[model samples]
Target: MADSVQRAFDLAAEDYDRTRRRLVPGFDDFYRAAIDLIQFPHDSQLKVLDLGAGTGLLAAFIAYSFPQARITMVDISSEMLERARARFELAGERFRFEVSDYGVDPIQEKYDAVVSALSIHHLGDDQKRSLFARIHGALNDGGVFVNAEQCRGATPERHRFHHERWITRVRELGVDDRDLAAALDRMKFDRAATLEDQLQWLREAGFRDIDCAYKNLIFAVYRGIK
Candidate 1:
């Protein structure tokens, strides 16, 4: 399943940004909301780690909004990171890129802020929980973690509804039926937890002041302070 998931994104990497930009109309709005909710230090140097930083979408926003921040963009897909690296070439020394699996990456350093978008849903519940703990540990005191995620609905019927809505959305974007089927089939193998459940897991992981800062159906920004 993991190999299949990786392959799907790898195959899509060449056109991922273009396809997403057309399909997900509100992509920038989501990123803006997530960024607005994050609290950073005024005069101190800030280090930010963007997990699952596909194509450097959110990283670009972070760079523009917080020009002084040192940004590390991490993802498991080399192809995606390659594009991300290219996107920030003009920034030069301000940004860094790394190919990493967030679930297994060791914590040698702490960050002032950790952000992810539309990525963590690939992991199962246990992986999600463990990653949250690792993220908490990776933070300096009073640091923040913000995740803009694809969440599961509260019930089976609601899940089906959200699934159908997403299918309709991608279909309208001209994604072929075959690709959409394959994607949905792969998702069926993994467990996507509800927003409430994820918030509870965050609390269990020793994060404080956790909340869902934004939501549009199954997509939400879950944030916490360490």
Candidate 2:
């Protein structure tokens, strides 16, 4: 299952970054809002881990924001990480790349922040809950967890509305029918949970100051401090 998902990401790796903006509604602000939550002195050498760090889109922003950060980018696809490697080639030891399925991997390293974007939504509800707990345990005191994710709506009707809104908006952004079909194909693997359930899971994982920092349609950014 993981291997097939990895293959899917690998297949999409080349065009992933270019099409991302058109595919997602409110792209810039959604990502900027997530970046805002990791409060730190710009020079701090923070230890950061990005789970399922596909093509390093989110990690690139983080690296730019926190220049001295020791970032570990973990994903199930080497193809994706290869792009990440090319993206961060000059960073040298400042960035580390690993191929691992974080949903089931042991994150034993203590990090100042653990972040993921558009990745955890692929996990089952049980997997998400357990992963939340692991993330909390892997954090240092005062560490934070930030997730920029796709979520389900609070109800079935709302889910339908959200779906419609996304479809309409993406089209407006000039994602053609073929591209939209491909995007929908990828979404088949998404196991998005409600924003409410995810917030509760963070709470259960012993996170404080948990909040849905930003939301639009079914896309949301969540932050929690350990």
Candidate 3:
């Protein structure tokens, strides 16, 4: 299942960054809030890790925000990472890339901050919990993990409403049929957890400060500090 999903993303790599703005409502604010919640000195030398960093969209934002940071990005899709590589080519050794499935793969080092965007929902609940534990272990003291993600509604009625509303909004944004179909196909692998359950997992992982920094309908930015 992960392999198929990786292929789907590889196929969409060329247009993934452009389509995200349309598919995700409030795209700017959703990401901006996540960046804002990161409590780090702008000029400090920080080590950051990005998981499932498709096209490096989120990592690009992080690089711009923290010029002194060294970033390592891991993703299952080499094609997607290729785009990220080209995007940050000028950074030289400052930016690094790895090809791996983050859920089952080992995270090699500790980081001052670990972040992921529009990823992790593909994992089952158990994988998500296990990954949270790994993330906690991988962080340096005072490090933080932030996930900007899609989430499932807690109840059937709310789930239906949110899904329908997202469909309507994306259609209103004038998404072409090709892109829409591709996005829907990829969503088939998404195993998004409810907001409450996700927060509980973070707590069990030994994070100190946990909070949903921002949420809009089914999209949210959650953070946990070690």
lDDT tens readout by residue for model 1, 1-226: 5665566667667777766653453667777788876777444478999998979988888877787889899888888899998898888887888887776777567999999988888898989999999999999999999998888998989988987887787777787766666556646645678998999999999999887877766678879999
lDDT of 3 at 134: 99
**lDDT, candidate 3, 117-197, per-residue tens:** 999999999999999999999999999999999999999798779988998898999898888888898898899999999
Q: How many residue pairs clash in each candidate?
A: 0, 0, 0
Cα TM-score per model: 0.89, 0.98, 0.98
Of candidates 3 and 2, the better by lDDT: 3
| For model 2, the run of ten residues with the poorest summed lDDT | 1-10
Span of 10 residues, lowest total lDDT, candidate 1 = 18-27
lDDT of 2 by residue, 52-140 (tens): 99888999898899898999999998999999999999879999999999989999789999999999998999999999999999999
Candidate 3 vs. true structure, TM-score: 0.98
What root-mean-square deviation over C-alphas does model 3 reach?
0.8
Q: Name the lDDT value of residue 225 in candidate 2.
A: 98
